[model samples]
Every structure is written in structure tokens, then in C-alpha cells.
Target: MSKNIDVLIIGAGAAGLICAITAAKRGRKTLIIDHANKAGKKILMSGGGRCNFTNYFIEYERYLSLNKHFFKSALARYTQWDFIALVEKHGIPYHEKTLGQLFCNNKSKDILNMLLNECKSLGVEILLNTKVNKIRKNEIEKGFNTKTAIGDIKCQSLVIATGALSIPSMGATGFGYEVARQFNLKVTETKAGLVPFIMPKKWLHHFGDLAGTSVNSQVSCNKHQFKESILITHKGLSGPAILQASSYWSTGDYIEIDLLPEKNAENWLKQMKIDKGDTLLSNILSLVLTKKFASKIVSLWFHNKPMKQLSEEDIQYIAEKLKCWKVWPEKTEGYKTAEVTVGGVDTHAISSKTMEVKSVPGLFFIGEVLDVTGHLGGFNFQWAWASGFVCGEVA
Candidate 1:
């Protein structure tokens, strides 16, 4: 048998659910299909289960895109306030985390429940465990037909909200990119974002033992800088600061980290030389950071030299090391632990205002499937909400 709908949304994710609900509410016959048995699997695991749904301070600057300004239209059309209003309407209690990021007061389930409840209220049809086997465009009707395990489904407007390949264990795949390619849409190269870094073998050999030891530091790569906690690991490094910097860091690019971010290393070292002149460099580092981390760093750099016996040049070198410790990571942990994918369908071929394909009308793309990616702290979720809402309005 064949099913027909006004709009068929692929992938019952955060974006797909939102788009489906919005379209159905507008009296459009909307159907959402997903291979996964359940919806919002990613949402259930986000923010450690609390789900950071959106940010209070949403700006275009937080997003990273090749065009850099392609997200402005949809984001402006459906702002963070609009999502906040939806949350309020659902009566989901939420609180603002640091830096204007918002999280559910209860659990991630609250956000998913809100979305699912809205979908039900709008009478949107949702099919779970529905695997799509093939997709072909109906040239006569200028529509797309999707052959699924269940049956064939046709729609005037088809939205690909399958998202990017990030958390594969949660059923992530490149089906969206594949579908785009089938339609001759240009897809940019993809990489992992918001992932951990893997230091060189030499650095790992020395610092691997300091796994789980974390400290606050300022991390910089490219033009991006973030002040957050960095945790050393057996593999290399992972933490908020490292993850934030990883988005901007590419292979072969060196990352600069200020270990003692708040202190002037030169001045502090000089003061320590006067106050505890006989103290060993390892002892001084131990006082500032954890003993294990200090010992490893000092042993590697200063050879555990006594502060009183060290020459001025040696002290200066130590100061420079503390002030600007450049970490030339061997590579990132890749998509295995990445929170989001960094690239997708090119923006040049799509309408920024409607998220519709410029060359292929009746086709739309939304959410993380597009090249538009946001930084950490709920920015991506806001993008999901904004893009889905706007696409639904126009789909």
C-alpha cells in the first residue's frame, strides 16, 4: 500500500519532531518516520539527562558556518524567546545555567515529553522503526517518493532532519547526506566537533598517568578562546575547555593553554624565588596545581631543579612554559565522542529564508543536517528549535 502526505519528515529527532508538530498544527497532513524504535534518543542523553534545550542569549556569532551568515534568517524568524514561550506553554520548568544556557529543571525527559505531547496535540503521525529502503523523485508530480520497510510514502514537501553522524551508538548515520547527494545537492566535507583532543605519544607517555586530574585553564585555538576546566586523560585530554577549543582546532594546529590563567607567571615565579628561594620547582608547581600534575610537568620541563640553584634564564624559561604551554595535539578523539558534527549540506544551494533547496523546490533541509553548526552550551539546540520552527512555518 502507499501513503500520501502533504509533508513527510525523516528522522524523529529534536528538529524532525518540532517540524512535524509545527506543520501538523497548521492543518498540513504531516508524517514523521524514523528507523529508530523511539524518538529523541539524543535528547534523552543530552546535558547528562537534563537536556540543555536552548540558550537565553542566542546570537548569530555563536554559530560556525562556511557562509557564517546563512543561519541569520531562520534564527531571526524563530528566536530563542519563541522556543522559551513553547516551553512555558508546555509548563516545563527550566532554569538557566551559566552563560545563559537553559536546562530542564527536572530531566531531559521533560523536554522530550513536551515535544512529543505537542506532536500528539497537532495530530502528527509518527512511525517508529520505519526503515527507508529507497528514495526517488516523481518527475511528473515534482515530489519525492520514499520506499520504506512499511510501505511507500509520497509527499509534496520532504524534510530531512536526520541530523549528522555524531553519536552512532544512538543510531546516528549519514543517511541525510546520502539523500542530499542523490538529489545532486552539494555536501561539504564533515568533521567532528565538541570532541576531545589526543596529544602526541611523547606528551601522552609523560602525562597519561595524570588521568582524571583537572585544572582551570584558558585554551585557545584559531581565534577562539575559552576559560574552562581541562582534564588530563590516559588517551590525551578532555574537558570543557579542550572540547570548546577542539571545534576550532584542526589537525597540525597547535593549541595554546595558560595553565595558571589568572596569575602572571613571571611575576609569580619571581615572588616565589624571594619568598621560598630554596623550594624546589616541583614543590612550587605542587602548591599551584595538583601534586601529581606538578611533579610530571616539573620532571619533564625543569628536571625537578631547585628554585634557588636555577639560573635566571632557566627561571624565565619556566615562567614562559607556565604562561603559554602550547599543546600540539596529535589529533582529536574524532566523532566517537563528539557532541555534534561540524559540517553538512552546503548552504549555497539552499534558500536561507525558507531552508528550501533553491534548485530543487519542494525539498527542505533543517537542523544539524545543514552546514550550520553552533558551539557548546545549548546553542545547537536553539538552532534546532529555530530552524525546525521556521521550516515548519514555510514547509
Candidate 2:
């Protein structure tokens, strides 16, 4: 005998769980399936376990999409304030981090618990460790027929919230992209966003040992810019500013890092030369930037010359390097460590209002599966909430 559900949600991450709760609250029989035994594994590990759940800055410009306006409807329908209200209702204490990112004061488990509790109150059925064998549509009625390791199930609506390929350790896969292709939807060029850059081996020899060293700098790619902490890793760079710029960066792209963001390089150097005329260049830079970076820049620009012996040309060159140090990254680390995939199901094929396929009735795409992908911090989770909320309301 075939089991029946009003809506069958694939994947048990943020989007699927939220959609299930919302649908069940409206008296729909909802079943969410995931191969993993536990739900929200990604959520459990996000934001250092406390979870950066949403961002205060959620303008469309913060997202990268094939059709940028496609996210407007859902985001407008379910704003960050709506999620804040739910958090307040659950009594989950949260606080805003820098740049309007909101994180739980406790742990990420509190978030998963709240979502699961909502599902239970709404009577949503959750199936775990379930392998889906197949998914097909009924020719006559246009309903979905899905066969899982447990059994076969039929549904009037099928919501694909499988997310994207990011943290493979959390079971992220290409299933969502595969499903989109199956329905004849155009999938855009996908790449790892919010991931680290891999410096060339030669430069790694020069910079990799500087791991754990961080600097406050202005990072720029093309015309986009971010003023945040930049960290040096064993392999390359990883930090708020670098991750933010990585989303807009591509192969062979030159990234400009302003080593001294607080003051004009030339003016600061002139002041330093006048005030601390006897101070070594390396020693003066050590006070403002990481000691290792200070040493490295001194090595590159000063040619082992003494600070007192510095020429006008040398001073000007150092100023330029300090103000605008440019490096063309060899390549990004890719989706294996990416926080979100850059592209997915084309927005042109999906309705901006309901997130439903224009041609394929009873089918929906939300969260990281759709064309929209948000910037670092909590914007991606906000998209998950917004898109899931809309799909749940209409599905």
C-alpha cells in the first residue's frame, strides 16, 4: 500500500524543516526525509555552533543571483524581523554580532530544538536515515510518486529544499542540482562562494607560515569592497573580508588589500619619519599591523636597507604597497569548504512570489537550491527562512 502525504519535503536542513512545520501548522500532512539520522546537522555546526541565524542587512545587493529581483518577494514577505519574532516566541536568547549578524546566546542546538518543537506541535512526520529510490510524477493527476527505502509515498506537492554543495562533511550533495536538471530547468554555472583562496605554492612559502596572523584591512574585488578582519592561514587567506570578497571573485581575479586602512599611507609615513626618526621601519609597522606582515613588507620593499638610510623613492614605494597591495589568487578552495554554492536552479523558471515552478505545478524550489545565494554571515539562513516561509504558505 502506498502511504500518502499532502506535502513531501526532501532534505531536513533549515529550509525543509521550516517548510514542514509551516505546512503541518496549516493542517497539511507533511513528511520530511533525509538520509542522515539527525536533522539540521549543518545548523548544529554553523556559526561556531551558536548559529548566525539571520542578518540585519538583508538588502538584495547582499545576494548573488541569476535574477537578483527574484528574491525580493519572498524576502519582503518574511523579513528578518519575522524570524526575530519567532525566536522571541520560543524564548531563545540571541544577540547581534558585528555588521548586524544575529547569533544565539546559547548554542545552535537551541535553534534545531525550536524548529523540531514547532514540527512536533504541528504534527509533522520526520523520516531519517531514509534512502530515496526514485521520484516520478503521475501522468493522469500530476501528483508526485516517490519510493524510499522505507516505502512508497504519494504527495500533491513536492518541495525541494535539499540545499547546495558546501560542507560535504555535513552531507551536502549535488542532489538539488540534479533534480533541477531532471525538470528541464536551466542551472547556472555553479561555484564555491564564501570560501578561502589558495595562494600559489611560492607565495605560500612566503605567507603560509604567517597563519593565525590577522589584520584589519579593506579588501576589494572588482568594485565590491569590505572593511573587516583579514586572516592569514597555512594555505591562504580566510576572514570576514576575504570570505565576503570571495563570493564576487573568479579565477585570475586580482584582490586588493589595503594594509593600512586607518590613515593615508604617505601621510602616516611622513609623520612617522618626523616623529620617530630613529625607529626602524619594521618596528614602526609592527605597532599598526601584524609583526609578521610588517617584517614581510619590509623585506619586499626595503631591500634589507636600514630605516635611516631609506630614500624618497623607497618611502613612496612602501606607501603604495601599504595602501594598495594586490594579489591575483590562483584559485578559490571550491565548494568543499564553501559556505554556500553560488548558483543553482534558474530563477526565470520559478515564480518569484510563491517559489513554484512556472511550468511544473506542485513543484517548488527554495533555499540554496534556487538561483539565489546570499553573502557571508547570516544572509543565507535568512534566504532559507524567507523562501521556506513563502513556499510553506502557498504550498
Candidate 3:
């Protein structure tokens, strides 16, 4: 019931699969194990099944980590262009969606199949539906004995690519964090990232009426601003802009949203008063924003007044409100609805260049298990590829 491998990768997710491919290609005896029935469950469902595999524009600042610069080395060594080339090599057609986010032309399964094919070509072993019960590192022999439901696995190097607690229904768990703690590694405060915000009851009542309505907006939080469409949800605010800002948001913090990012509201209002004095303020707003939202704004702020009735002060006030509408979020939707986990095993204790535990040789952590969380888009997947590739080179 005991098997030995040169490299043992836990969790046959994005990182583990890539790591196995890399190691096996290098002639190492690699085996990737996962408890899931099949590999790449997340990848199959990501980006509405298209899978945003990597971003066209990648930078070090796009990732959040305790050590901001830790990802630079791996990312640089395994660039997005490299992955893109591989995808092209496989003849899996892909296209850029927006803001440099690339997605498969068909389905996420294409990306998964590409990785699987590469691993197969290299003779990598993938054991699915196998749960690891215990992992004990042998200090004297510099190896690991991992007990699983299938059997006992012994390996010279162990790679923990088990992702953090993001989507519990997808079988996501804190197994990676538990493994890190078993080895006496430091883990930072964890929270949901790339999640939608739930507004206060009063605010929800007013905005919930506009649920399903989308508006072009510029949302800012924690000094980060995103210009995209914000959707009004029954629970609260969502859409790309709101979701991007949510990564930087905490409870009690207010988010500033520019409803009219493309226009000078004050100047436009003054001109409207001169040209169409008979028009209602709500009518003017309806031209740019949704009629329901405009009517609500007029009822709440202007008392449904006509354009001619507003004084210079009122004009200025309305303009300022449109430019900087602030709203406080009660809380996030939590990990159940989050795209990724914000914090994880502290990067300071790991070698950024090798993705190896500095104090514990042959032990490695990669992908979402690390504290590094990428911004919305394909950045997270890119991190998985880069970190896994780097670790496979040495591990």
C-alpha cells in the first residue's frame, strides 16, 4: 500500500497540474493527487465556463500580498506570453475579452484538456478521488509520508497547491492552511476577495428597486478606482466595477462612485437649464441613466423639481452628488460567493524565487494557497501557472 514518487503534488487543481507537467517533462517521477472526482473543477466553471486563463497585461502591482514583490520573479520567469504560446500550440482558440482578459473561444474544458494532454505526454500520474488523511515529513531522510484513502505515498518533495476557502460547494477547503500550520508556518488573516457587497437595509431598499439595472460607473475604494459597469443587485451592488472595488473594501468603509464619469454634471445641468428650462431634472437624468434610477435620485435629492427651479447652490450640490456618491457596504457575500481568498500562508516564510519553504526544504506552496491574490480577470490563473512552473523547476 506504499508508493514512492520523486515529486508529490497535492490538489490536482491549476497549480498542481502545471507543476506535475513541468516536473514530469524534466524526467521526474511526478504524481498529482486530489480528492475531487475530476481535475479542474474551478477551471471548468471559471469565467462563465470560458476560463480567463491569463491576462494580456500583467504587472506586479496587480497582485495583493504581504510581500508585494514576491511574485515578480516567478511571473517574470513564466510570463503570460509563454502560456499564450502554449495555448496556441495546442490549437485552442482564444480571444481577449476586455482589459486584456483572455478567455477560451469554446469552453473552459479546452484549457483543462490542454493541461491534461501536456501532463499525459510527459507521463505524469494523476490520482483523483483520493483523500490525503495525514502528511508527515521525515526530517532525517528529507522526505514526506502522506497517508491517503487509496494508499500511503512517500515522496522526496511535497507541493501543496490546495487552494484556499473560496467556493465551498466546489470542494474548496482550508486543507492548505492546515498543512501550513502543521509545519509551523505563519498564515495571515483570511477574508473573501472579489465578492459583491451587501448594502445596509435602508440603502438596499432604495437601490434594490433598481435591481438588474446596470450603469456605467467609476467606483473607488482604498485609493483604487475601476471604471466599468456596476449592476444593481437585489442584495447590493455588483458588476465588474463594484467587484473590483470590493477587493479593497472593508466594513464601515465608504465607496465613492461616479455615476456620470463621462460628463461634467454641473456644467451640463447649467446648460440644460438655459436650453430646456421646462424639462424636469429627472427627465434630464433619464437621458443618461436608467429611468427608474433617475426618478429615484430626483425624488430623494431634488424632490422631483424642474430644471429652472434649481438655484446655483442646488446645481452645484447635485453635480457634486453625482460625481461622488458615497455608500457604505454592510458586509461582503463571504467565501461562498467569493472568487478567491485574500490572505493565506505568509509569503515572508517562503522563498519567492523557488516557491519553497525557506526553513523546510522540499516543501512548497503555490497558487491561491499563498497570500498573493490577483485582481479580477485572468491574473489569478496566471499566478497559478507562474508559481507552479517555478516550483516544478526546483522542487
Computed on alpha carbons, the lDDT of every model, listed in order, comes to 0.89, 0.88, 0.93
Candidate 3 minimal-lDDT segment of 10 residues: 297-306
Candidate 3 per-residue lDDT over residues 1-395, each given as its tens digit: 88989999998999999989888888899999988999989999999899999999998889998898999999999999999999999999999999999999999999999999999889999998999999999887788999999889999999999999999888798999999999999999999999999999999877788899999999999899999999999999999999888888887899999999999999999999998888999999999999989998888877567889989999999999999999999999999999999999999999999999998999999999999999998999999999999999988
RMSD of 2: 1.5
Candidate 3 lDDT at 391 equals 95
Candidate 3 local lDDT, residue 7: 98
lDDT per residue as tens, model 1, 93-186:
9999888889999999999998999888888989999998998888998788989998999999999999998988888999999989988998
Q: Model 2 residue 346 lDDT? A: 93
Q: How much is 221 displaced in model 2, in angstroms?
A: 1.5
Ten-residue stretch with the least lDDT total in model 1: 302-311
Tens digit per residue, CA lDDT, model 2, 176-268: 888788889899988898999988898888888789999999999989998998999988999989999998898989999998888888878
CA lDDT, candidate 1, residue 155: 93
For residue 185, model 1's alpha carbon misses the true position, in angstroms, by 1.2
Residue 60 accuracy (lDDT) in model 3: 85
- The true-versus-predicted C-alpha distance at residue 235 of model 3, in Å, is 0.8
- Top candidate (lDDT): 3
